[model samples]
Structures are given as C-alpha cells and as structure tokens.
Target chain A: MKELRWGLLAAGTIAAEFAAGVDESKHGVLEAVAARSGDRAAEFASRFEVPKCYGSYEDLLADPDVDAVYISTPHPLHGAWAIRAAEAGKHILCEKPLTVSVSEAEKVIEAARANDVFLMEAFMYRLHPQIRRLAELISSGAIGEVRAVDVAFSYNFATPRLTDPALGGGGIFDVGCYCTSLARLVSQAATGQDVVEPEEVLGMARLDENGVDEVAFGLLRLPGGVLAQLACGFQLTQDDHIRVYGSQGQLYVPKPAWIHEMRKPKTSQIILTPEGGEPEVIEVEATQGLFAREADHVAAHLADRQAPELTWAETLANLRTLERWRAAVAR
Target chain B: MKELRWGLLAAGTIAAEFAAGVDESKHGVLEAVAARSGDRAAEFASRFEVPKCYGSYEDLLADPDVDAVYISTPHPLHGAWAIRAAEAGKHILCEKPLTVSVSEAEKVIEAARANDVFLMEAFMYRLHPQIRRLAELISSGAIGEVRAVDVAFSYNFATPRLTDPALGGGGIFDVGCYCTSLARLVSQAATGQDVVEPEEVLGMARLDENGVDEVAFGLLRLPGGVLAQLACGFQLTQDDHIRVYGSQGQLYVPKPAWIHEMRKPKTSQIILTPEGGEPEVIEVEATQGLFAREADHVAAHLADRQAPELTWAETLANLRTLERWRAAVAR
Candidate 1:
C-alpha cells in the first residue's frame, strides 16, 4: 500500500515509457529524473512532470527522496549503472538484456546483494496481467499439458542501431532476449518445475557490420522434452505475439508480447480451443501496470526482507542460457 | 507434351487424393492400381477407372505400362517402395518426409538416379499455385529483402494411425516436416542460395508411448543469419499457416501452410507493405486442388526428361535438416 519513490536514469524513449507507467501507477511515484546532461535531464523531467532532475546519475541516486533507481541505459551500461545505483543505497530496476554479457550481470547481482538493496530486471511483459493469467490457464490444464511454445519479438530497427555495435544494438540483445526470457518464464510456470537450462542451444544470428546480432533464432529444450522456438530481429517488420500450445487449448498474447511493453487496459487475451471445440478468447486485466507488479512484488519482498518473486538463481539460469547463445553465435 | 502414365500406389486417404488429381489432369492418367490384396486393388482400380489392378507391390512394379509410381505408403516403408519402384524403371512421387531418415533417403535417391528416372519427394503444398506465386513474389523482391520466416503445422493426430511409431507416428515427421521444409525452402528462395544447414539445431518434442516425437519444434539458422522458427505437433491440435516477413512487405500463404495440404480457393494473399508505405493484399484464387500444380509440375518434368521442379539435391538438403532435428530429439 506504500508508494515506492522512484528515480529515473537516462532520458530515452524506454525511460519515458517506464516513467509514464510510474505516473499512471497507484503504488509508485516518479521522485526524480537524471541524464548525463542537465539540459536533457531537465527536459525529460518537464515532459514527465517528475519532482526533480539531476545532471548526473550519482546526483539522482543520492537524492534522499528517491527509494529506487530504474536503469534504462543501453545493454553495456546496465551493469555499471545498476552497480552504481545499488552502491548509492537505492533499490534498482534495470532494463532487459540486463547486461550485454553474463559477467556483467554477475557484477550487477553482486552489487545488489552486497548492498542489501532490491534489484529486479524490468521484464514488464511477464508481470502483465495477461501473462500471469496465461500461466494460470496453462497450470490449470486449460490447454492440456504444455507441449510447445512459440515466442517472437521483432521490429524494424535497421537504421543506426544496425551499424553501431557499441550500443549492444542487435536482435539477440534487443529482442531475442525477450523471447528467451519469456520461454523460460512460461516453461517454468507450465511444468511446475523450474525450467531447466536448455541441454543444447543452437543459435543463428545475422551479424551487422558492427558485429552485433541483427536477428537471431534459437531452440531451447526443457526437462519434459518441451521445445520453445524463439525468433527475434531488429531488421524485420513484425507483429509481436507469443503463443503457448498445450494439450487442451492454446493461449495467444495479442500484443506487448514482452513484460515491459504494457498496453492500455493492461491485459491480453487467452485463446483456448478445447478438443472438438471452437476457439475462445478471454481478456485479462491486471490490477497494476506490468512494470508496477514487479515493483510492488519487489516492495513486498523488501517489506518482508525476502527475495523477489524471480530469485537470484532464476536470474543466473536465464543469464547462463543467454551467455551460451551469445557464445554460440560468437564462435 | 508427353502424357505421364501414373500408377496409384495405395487406396488410402492420400492415395485417393492423388487419384483425384490424376483423374482431373490433362497430362496424367491412372494407368495402374496396387494394394496388398487383389480385391482392394480391384476396388481402387474400379474407383479410379485405372486399366490395371495388381494384388502385390512386385506385380505393380512389373507392369511395364506404368510410366511412374506414386508411393503413398507409411513413412517407414517409403524408402523400400521408392527404391523398388525406381528399380522397376519407373519415375517416383513419394509422400513427404521423403524417407524416415536421411540415410534411407540417400538409398532412394541412388536408386532413382541409377534408373535415370524422374524422382520427387511429393511435398504438394509447395506446388500450390498460391505458394508458387508467394515464392515468386519473395524472389522478385516484392517483399523487399526477406528477413524472417515463421511456419506452423499442427494437428491433433493422436489418432490410431498417428499413435503407431511404425507409421512414423508423431508431429515432427507427420506434420513438423512440412514446417521445417517450408522454412528451408522460403529461406533458400529469399536468400538466392542453397539453404545452409543450421549451425546448431535446437528442438523440443512430446514423446509418445512408443518413444517417438509426438509434438515438436525446431529453430534453424541459414546463411546471412536468416532465422526460421517452426512449430509442429500431433497433440496440441491442428493449424496450418506460413508467414514470410521481409523488409518491404510480408507475404502470407494463409492456405496450405504445410506441404500437400489443399489451400481453399481465393484465401491466399500476399500483403505488400513497402517501407514508409501502407500494406497491399493481393488475393490469388486456388488454381485447382493442391495436388494439381504438383501433378502438372511432375508431368512437365517428365515431359522435359528433367529432374522434378524440387530436385533431388533440394530434397537431400531438406532430409538432412530433418535428420539432425530427429537425431537431436532421438538422442
């Protein structure tokens, strides 16, 4: 019931989207905004109506009024900013592809644990009401036993991002990570067992001139022989959709397929088609913004002095799969 | 053009479908009928108005009047029948998943070439007029530079025929093969090169009581990092659809998403969405039954004394991919 005071790091499109979510929230407040430059920070602050703006990340993290800092910088910078925010004694919410590499992710986690401050990956789609309801339906055998999962998050980002490897600009990091994360999340929920690391990973990626993956596809194998086929790209046009095929029926998430990109009404529909049955679509509306659910969940964890819903172990497992995939393509 | 004297190999569902295609063709004829029993062969002969009825495979192969034989038997027996038919100096049109394994497919190919006969893995869906148009469009840069391809072919084939491992029961071979084949075909056509073997194959499958794959998925990477994700199953219900995404536009073969499946008339359309432009959907009427185009193509190939439209080399490429996927699961 307590509103978590939030500080924004970086003034980019994603930062604005997250700030909008915070402003529309009932359990969170945009206490401040920050960027590398004072003018940019002030501009972002004015647009979002945040109470204060800071020219430096350290200044925002130091604000006594700020409880947590949401790090929305590029992939390479996520770890540094997260560790810095944690060191500053603020709880942290880092954007996805949490860090460009697994070692970087480890440093982020270490900083959070070392500082004893809450650290959560801002995977908003998983927190969306529709995804939770989907997990529920699959668990209830709505679609029968979980058999296969297909997840795709592709967009036309073939401009400057395709040419800049420094920004961690490519499909695997920018979009494929979401596909892989969702697979792990849904697999774990469906099997009622932690979705195990894929025994073998076969990844293929189109490397841009900058040597970053522009598009990638992967096959993940779960414990029960469940297969998740994930495809993502920054150079292709796409309709973001995630489909889980179970024995009884299927659940189709219409849009905002990932955790963070929450759509209005804050929900997606579950399409269930029972045997010899017609397809039924049901929409689920969540009580909180998908981003806020994690924030709320993290707050509750902080209040109870417990770990977040997704444990550090799960985070490590997710990172391992990602690292293996990246290594596969790099080779 | 020379007429193709076709022998109907079985009286099963697919055989009946092929008979209908021959019956409606101008350049092909049902010259012979073959089955395990004389009575069944007679019945098939009567139904299709064929000139000859043979009680056994040997008798049918010995019929010098038959110019070509269509092998519509179970997957496990495909190699044997195809090889036998080839040894008898007849061209062949074997059902999809050319043979259960690539090793077997190699033998079938060897036999066909030794006899200097036309041979084709009968993936009828690819020959559908709409599919041809879609492929042509993509090759013509109608969708601009292709980026990603997604294909799904699932049907609840948990029936008695599909439940038997002897019949190649399960989704991957039964249905998933089409998905993978389409992925490869589209990728090859889009990239203007032989589709490369995916560097790594990742897959998941639901095992049947017989320990064969029941529901399966595969993600593949071809050269240029083109990513193809495929989902297929016998347990999760049935859906046949293929979508090709490119830079300028996208083409959806709404019908016949799988090989040999009949696409309903006029339901196929190519949606062209150029960069910074609106989408245009061009509807194509089904020219005839899905098998008609394959029948015509085969007829043409035979007349020209050339290899099938989808050559032995292409079939070999497809079989290799299928073998790796099955091996990944079987291991």
Candidate 2:
C-alpha cells in the first residue's frame, strides 16, 4: 500500500479538520503543517503529531517528505499557493471555489498538468457516500426525470474571509459553489452524462455594507430543462437541505453543504418520496470520516492525477458557474 | 346565533369538499347545489342532503334563502358567477386565483361591495390554525429577523383545471398563487403590516404544449430585503415544504399549499430550528376540517363583509402578484 504524505497549508479550521481526518485515513499521513502564523502552525503541528512545521507555505511545499499538499488558505491565496505547490512537485488537494475566476482556475489546472501532479478540488461533501447514493437514485429513475433541484447552504457567520470582496469572500464564492456543483452533478446523473453545463444562469444578491453579497440566489437551467435553484448567505441562517424534484417523486438530502468529514461519524438520511406514495428514508451510515474518505479517494487516483468522480473539467466548470452566478447577481 | 345558508356552485371536487365541510360548520348549512351538469348537481345535492338542486347557476343564485355562495368553478368562471351571486344578495366565498385576470377579480370585488354582500377568497390554508400560529410566530420574532421565505406547491396531478390554459390552467394560477400569497403573508407578518406587496417579482417557467406553465419559479423581493422564492409545478412533484429562513433561525412547515379542509385531519408540525440549537416542533391539532374552520371564520365576519384573515384587498393583491409572476416568466 502506498502512503501519501500530506502537507497542510494554512492552519485554518478546515485544515485542522483535514489533518484530524487524515490521521484516520487508510493510505494518507499528515507529514507537515504550515501557515503564515508560526504560533498557529506550531499549535496545529503539535496537536496533530506532525514531524515538520513551517512558518510559510513555500517551506511546506518544498519539503521532500510531503507527497501532497492540502491548500486551505483564504480564497485569494488558494490559486497562487496551489500553483506554487504544483511547481514544487507536490500533488494538490485545493479547497473549493477552486479559484476566484475561471482564468485563475484554468491557470491552476494548467500548472498542475505542466508539473504532472495530482490535482483535486476539495469538495468533501461530494466524496461522501450519501452523495453517491443520491446520484445512484437519480440515475436509477427512482425520482423519475429530474425537473428541479433546490439547495440552500447558508449561515449567519460574518467571517472576514466571507465578507470581503478583495479576499474573494461572498455567498457565491464561500458557499454557493457547493450548490452549483451539486446541482450540475444531479443534472449529469439524471442525463447519464459525466458532467452538464447550465444553458442559462440567473442570479440575485443582497450586498452587505462592504459591497460583498451577504445573501444570494441563483437559478441554473441545465440542458434538458432541469432547473437548479441555489440560495446561500453570509448574513442569514437557512435550512441547508438539498431537494430534487422530479416527475414521479422527490428526494431530500439534509445538511449536505459542508460536512466536516471528522465529525464523529453519524448516520445521514436521504428521503425519497414517490408521487402519491409514502416516504422512504434511505439511511447512509458511513464508516469513515468525510475528509478521510476524500483523502483516500484522492490517494487512490493520485496515479491518474485526477479523480474520476470529480475531474479537472468538472472542477473548473463549477468554478466558472459560481463566478458567473456571482457576476450575474450584480448585473 | 345567526345561521348562514350556503349554496354550492359548480359542484366540482372542491365544491363537494366545501359542502361536506359546511355540514360540520357551527353556523353554516348547505342549502342548495348547482352545476352546469344537472346530473352532478342532483347527485351532489342528494349526497350532501341539500334541500334544493338547480341545473343552472342562475337558478341557484335566485334561491332567496341562500345567504352565501361558495363558488368552486374553474378559474375562468369565478368572476362572472361571483358577480351574479353578489347581485343576487349572497355573500361570496370565491375559490383561489380569484379570477384569471386582475380586472376580473376587481370586478368581482366591486360587485360584492356594491351589493353590500360579504366576500372572501377561500384560501383555506390561510384560515387554518396552523397558519395563524405561523403568523404569530413570525410576528413574535421567534426566528429573529425574517430574511427569506422559500415555498413549493406542486404535485404531478394533471387535472383539466390545472393543465388546460383555456380553463385558466397553469402552475401559477392552479398552485403557484398559494406560494405568492404565503410569501407575501410572511413578509407582511415580519414587517408588521396588513399586507406587503413584493418590491420586485422575477419569474421563469417551463411551459407545456398547451401554452401553460407546467413548472415555474418566481422570486419576490419584498420590503426590507426579504426574498421569497417560490417553485410550483403541474408537471412535477416537489417537497412542497414552506421554509422561513431568518437571521437567527429557520422554520419549516410541511404540505402547506393545498390542504383539503375535509380530509381526515391529523396533527401537523411546524419545525423551528434556532441557529446552533436543537429543533423544537410545534404541533397543530385541529378540531374542525379546514373548510369548516374557514366557513366559521367567514360566518363570524359576515357582519364585517370581509374576512379579516384573508381580506378582499389581500386577495386582489395576491392575484396581481401571481399574474405578474406568470407574465414575467414569458418576458
């Protein structure tokens, strides 16, 4: 069994979660932890029992023992750091909204390809078993032809990274990308395509005092007339359930937007209700943490450089869609 | 105690439910049944044990003993019959989407006012105790500042009045009106107003072959930046849950759009989830059918000539909002 040595870049909340989850990974080990703040990096390293700690991301990327880097920096920093990590000959698992714009994401992908490094966007929820089950149900026509998907991923958190435009913070970038990705994934599964792009995207937002979206709504009309509606926010709390409406039934997935893989592992549910029939609750009991599963998935596909389930094309497309939605809100 | 004499008009499925509900009403009785089809009228009258049966609407309107008429005809016929009913000195309980057009609904109200007859739109769900509690909760700010209201009222039933544009069928009129009205109501309750019209209404639809919207989505930007998103369809089945997303919490109401007032009633829940808090379920156990409660509400307010809960002005505004949504779908 090949063990993937993981380097944590930016000792933030998500990085800590990933570090904790990687501790339980079957083929991944936390090798180094780095951040702009040495105190945070040392604290994270000491807490996670990592052998190496660095005050800068470059040092972590340059470490010979580190095979892959998990980039958890704030939005604007992800693109540059991922590019640097790839140039350093390290595989990269970057946090989502892959980059602030399509060009940045494209550049990141281009760099990864040039360096021949494994690259995967960190959408941990997509790697969850529940999402796979949902896709299977959709493909099996259990919900009939998918007609509409409604998703909400929002909270009242006014985190600095989510409220400042310069940092690439907003509802669309911070959380709405989850909605866009899942919606496109549903369309792909329903149509039996690897991925599907929305034919039209419409969006609206309520901007905060800082000129970033505090709350936003977007509509995606996919090929074959599937409409996916997304609502995300940085200033308000919402029921973060994902619903798929179909010709014959409806499927409900609960709190799916941001599942920290290491949350003590609990059983989740996907509720399916056929038209004029009783509800059938499909339970998903996972044996591994979400980040652990995601890390293992990336490790298994490291040789291929891209995970089959969430390919580079899909990640870049999702970033483009999310940015399009954000720009459309202003228009 | 004053007893209200009810005349059944059009003898449709809704009319049948209304008649059965009036049987359990404290202050109303079904006095006559009328339909274009004499057989339906006769059979309805016999089944409900009404003393009078009329083959034509005019005959039933001429029955001097009938104090009120429950107009349950299809969308296109509501205005004309309500006007005639008012002229014949009967209080009017017209079915939803009061008329296909705003002008028609206005005329119906005008006639009712001119004849000094009580008039109300039969939005039975609004008259339900559960709705009252929901309004109270909003007014009490139990969920903090209301930020968004998301509603879906859809089923895969393609009945004539829901699929045929000639009869004023479509998603907006057949079912989406409920979404608009409830969304508006949530706004009003949050803002502490009698009724608050949306500042902006944006809509999109997937039309079926009959030139009617089979599925539709609408966005209502109400006063104070509250957004109400509605998804309604005739060609699909949705979760049909009403969610009120707020600054501090979210509330969920199930199957709220269309409640058959006369069905075997069960306890319904209103799930309130405060941010970072466990969900608290509020149960509503009604002693009367939905129609029965609505009839009693109307009977109590007959002296006022308009039901306070669903005023004539609110009804007219809801129709206008629904039409605007439908029209925007095309533009």
lDDT of each model, Cα atoms only?
0.76, 0.86
lDDT of 1 at B21: 83
Candidate 2 chain B: worst-modelled 10 consecutive residues by lDDT:
B257-266
Output the number of the TM-score-best candidate.
2
Which candidate number would show the highest lDDT if scored against the true structure? 2
- For model 1, the superposed segments whose C-alpha errors exceed 4 Å read A1-3, A158-163, A194-196, A257-267, A286-301, A305-308, B1-4, B100-116, B159-170, B191-204, B207-211, B223-225, B257-267, B275-278
A146-256: candidate 1 lDDT, tens digit per residue: 777777887775656445778777777777877877788777777787545776776767676657777777778765556777777777776677778776767677674
Per-candidate Cα RMSD to the true structure, in Å, reads 3.2, 2.5
> Looking at model 1 chain A, which ten-residue stretch has the lowest summed lDDT?
A256-265
Fnat of each candidate: 0.76, 0.53
lDDT per residue for candidate 1 within B96-204, as digits (tens), equals 8889888888898899878888888888777666677777787788878777778888776567768788788777878877777778877777777754456566665
Per-model TM against the reference: 0.90, 0.93
